[model samples]
Target: MGQPVLLSLLVLLAVAQGVVLAYWAIRDRRFRSAHRAARHLHSADTHAGRLALVGEIAGSIAHEISQPLSAILTNADAAENLLGEPDPPLDEIRRMLADIRRDDLRANDIVRHLHSLLKRRELQTTMLDLNEVAATALSLIQPVARKRLVTVRSCLDPMLPPVRGDAIHLEQVLLNLMMNAMDAMASNTANGAAERILDVTTDRYDKYSAAITVTDTGPGIAAAYRPRIFDSFFSTKQEGMGLGLAIARTIVHAHGGKIWQEGTSAGGAAFKFTIPLQAA
Candidate 1:
């Protein structure tokens, strides 16, 4: 009887020890993962990286701004030339003045977007209309899309309830995603793809949340790269810093949202993100 009791006790003790070892191993793995994540976030949120991103689209923005300025100059010249005429053509000059003012406002809107994007401030949360936010982001991306020969379209839901989020950060998310889609399509277009189109759609996900999706008619992500698409420092592009999707994920998560890639039915790529609606 004593020998049997001793054998049972030894077996129980060994099992307890095994369980303790497994728990510690799991904790250690979690801690290491968290540490690595912190490091990646720190590295990705640098001023230089932001500036580099801005630089990537700076030419397109400059062209956009210059178009309005040139239009204003042409209108101004016409107004001046009319003022020197015998009759002065008051009605014609008035129309030219209106055109000049409209052009100025257009340029101002672009600059405002730049100012908001370039402003270095803490994340601010407020009630935001997702449609307005989407419109602003699409406006900024339109110039680059046009230049790249990509047809950009949006189907924003007018009834999307307000979501509490940081406008600048959310816009950053949209810009990053759109620009990424453009980059992906650029290479595919170079490879003899017939047409490149980007579609932005927003809708109410459910009673508690709203969703936005950006889809591109480009070669979809490879099977091997799908899993790590949002992982920091894991990029398919040779020169990519591999932080855009990661940063976007962090921002979306911070705003009580989830971001993920929704594989397209055909041979394209689509990404969708959802944010909870603001509490009444």
Candidate 2:
């Protein structure tokens, strides 16, 4: 009787071990699959596409960085002149140094933001403030907006909740929407719409989601094209590959959010997207 019971116990242990191994194997496969999909989403093609957008504002970026550099040089020259004086104004020289340092940091930040966008990497999730993300995107695009004479406005909600997602990807989405808005208004500058305005706003869509909207004072989407606006490779621009909206939708959806366009019969286009707030 004892021997029979011991054999049964051995069989039960072996079955439990097999089940555990099977479960881990399936989990590992799922994890690899998800990782591969994410890599594909942020592939070399996506990076190239982003670089193309950067190229559009390359001159503006150069000018933005050059301004700070010019300031630093001017301050340095003034400080040198002060040193040459018999009774140099040490106080003034200190102020000049401070100005130079500030300009240096400004230039560094511009480069850092640009570099972060250009880098190719996997998605990294973190708690983020949508307001800050919008502000950063605006800072990066301000030079371009100024060059094009587009008035940019932002209304960020101070009570906005934190969201869980990749900040870089979210910024990319915001930049894409804002760029598209600017492009939409480009033709309007010559047409009836005299005021070229781009508005970005952040707020809570509901108890669980934070939303952002990018609106433009351009001619709204036609009734015919409204349905397939987010479809891949459906660009209205002659030189556009039509992936911007598609990618934006994908990224937003991946974060458990939704994106949609508001009708603008009066004259203007609004694209809004939401990201779910982090759970308690």
Which digits, one per residue and each the tens of the lDDT, describe model 1 over residues 1-280?
6999999999999999999999999999999999888755544583344555577888999999999899999999989999999889999899999999999999999998887777665557899998888999999999899899899999999888899998878888888899999988886554464478899999999888999999998788999999999998889888899988988888889789999996787688999999899963
Worst 10 residues of 1 by lDDT: 42-51
Q: Report how far residue 37 has shifted in candidate 1, in Å.
A: 14
Residue-level error in angstroms, candidate 1, position 85: 2.5
Which pairs of residues have clashing backbones in candidate 2?
Answer: none
- lDDT tens per residue, model 2, 1-280: 6998999999999999999999999999999999898778656546666677688777999999999999999999999999999999999999999999999999999899888888886567899888889999999999999998899999999988899988878888899999999999887654444589999999989988999999998888888888998998998788888988988888788788999999665589999999999863
> In candidate 1, which residue ranges exceed 4 Å CA deviation?
1-49, 190-194
Q: How many residue pairs clash in each candidate at the backbone level?
A: 0, 0
TM-score, prediction 2: 0.86
Give the C-alpha miss distance for residue 43 in model 1, angstroms. 10
Best by TM-score: 2
